[model samples]
Structure formats: C-alpha cells, structure tokens
Target: MSDTAPTAARTEAQTMLIAFDGSPEARRALTYAAEFLRPRRVEILTAWEPVHRQAARAVSMSGLRQADWSPSGEGEDPAYTEARETCREGVNLAESLGLQPRAHMVECATSIWSAIVDAAKELRVDLIVSGTRATSGFRGFWQTSTSENVIQNCGVPVFVVPPAEEEPDADC
Candidate 1:
C-alpha cells in the first residue's frame, strides 16, 4: 500500500467547443486547437441566421416590401443545411486530428456571438475556440468581430485564431 492518499482519477476527457463557419479562418482555428490545445473531446458549432430572418432584415434595410415567406415543411432551410454541412466538415477535421468530435448547429436568434456563448454554457466546455476574419476600418466598426464579442461575453476561456497574413509582394 502507498503512503500517499489516492486521488480520484478523471474519467472523462476534456471537452472543447469550436466555433466554425466553414471559413478558412475557422478551419485554421480548429487546426490550431487540435495541434496546440490538444483537447480530447470537441464540439464543432456552426451558428447561422435563418433565411426568413435574413429576408426580413434585408426588406427592412432596403425599404422593400416584405414578401410572404415561410419555410417549406418538405425541405430544410438552405442556411441551416449549410450550417450542418459546415459542422460535418469540422467534425471530419477534428476526427482527422484524432479527437472525438460532435457537431452542433445553433440559430443566431440574437447574434452569432450570443449563440456561441450560449452553446458554450450549455455544453460546459473547458474552452472556446474561434476564428477571426480580421475585419477593419468602417466595416469593422459597424460589424463587431464575433470572436471579440464572444470573448467579452463568455465566462469560459476563449482562444481566437486570426486569419493568416498575406505574403508581401515580391515586386515591391
């Protein structure tokens, strides 16, 4: 018998929540998480705005008449479908990295950042990994970075991977 008291062993692997939008930046973030963070369990999330909601916003902004738009019961929304596909791709990437991955799709009811934060809270993940588009200038000012927003709102630790830098011109 050992002199030291035996400590409880951790049975479950550490879980990480990754925010993926099918973008190159998001893919890089996932790769970074797998290679550096080395999380054993991962949840890949794709947050998307509903088609109808997008149309409504477009109408409101453009002063166009709102058309009667409803989801067809026979088919899924393209936005949701795309989100699912993106999540699948992320899952595949994670699996290739040798980490167990699950896919999650969440509607951007309020904001994409909010959706990510809520999902993180619900999943009870150890960390949140996201990619930034690195928007700047007027557009950046008007549309706040999703990674920045998630970092500000979420209680969990957030790892934001920025887009790869462009190579300098050889002619210059």
Candidate 2:
C-alpha cells in the first residue's frame, strides 16, 4: 500500500470579507485570496469615519465650542463618498481577478478595525482577508495595526498578507 494519507473532504463554497482601503497591501491580500483560498463570494469593505464626528473630535481637542462648527446637510459626507469609491474600486479589481464580489461601505463608529470586525460578523463570512502595512518599532507600538486587532478579536479565521519585500539592487 502507498504511504500517502487520506485527505479530508472539501467543504461547501465559502464567503469571504476583505478589508480594503485601496492600498497596495490590500491589493496584495485580494490577489493572495484569489490565488489561494478561491472563495465563492467576496465582500469588499471600506470603512470611514463621518465628517461630523471628525469635526467634533477636532473641536473637543482644541477646546472650541460645539457651535463653532456644524456639518453641512447638503449631501453625503466626503469621508463616506471616498469610502464608497474605494469599495467600488476593490469590487472592480476583484471582478477582474475572477472573483464574485460585492461592494460594502461602513461608517466607522469607533475604529476601522472595529468596523471591519462588525461587518465580518454581520456578513457571516467564513474568512477575513486583510493586509498589514508592516509597521514596527515605536511607531507600530503606538499605532496598533488593524490586521493585528482583527486577528485578536475576530471569532472567525483571518488571512493577513504582509508587505512585499523590496527587491535587491542590481548594482549590488
């Protein structure tokens, strides 16, 4: 008899949530997922903080009166608009890579990581795909990476794509 072990049966099609922010690292994560996991459905999510909330924070920090600033009710917040565009870009990229993708924009109530985790839970995705900026040292310590937080808090599995390595110089 052969020495090879039997493989487990494959599960049904999986749904995946990708935290996208139109960064090169995010693109790499999407490419990795498409090449490796091959999930049946993908949700491209872009999270942004509302303009009013941001203005409020600025005012509070500067010790300015709340009445000094007011949100324009004319149209959608610029942050939300940018997030929607980013999500659309991600969906297009996913489609070009042969993935069935849907765009999702989330308003960040607390933090980007929190929004991503909440969206993943709401979507009931089998896996979360994210990319790391590869921050380290004092800066990294001060500013916690989103992927790190997601991995720690997300109940589901997470696939994180690290920043690409720099190419060696030809002259060297």
Best by TM-score: 1
Give the range where candidate 2 is weakest over 10 consecutive residues by summed lDDT.
3-12
Expressed as tens digits, the lDDT of each residue in 53-77 for candidate 2 is: 9888778879978765467788888
Q: Residue by residue across 91-135, what tens digits does model 1's lDDT show?
A: 999999898998999998978999999999999887899999999
Model 1 pairs in collision: none
Model 2, stretches more than 4 Å misplaced?
A: 1-12, 57-67, 168-172
> What's the true lDDT of residue 40 in model 2?
57
Every model's TM-score: 0.88, 0.84
Give lDDT: candidate 1, residue 50.
84
Candidate with best lDDT: 2
lDDT for 155 (candidate 2): 94
Q: RMSD of each candidate?
A: 4.2, 4.1
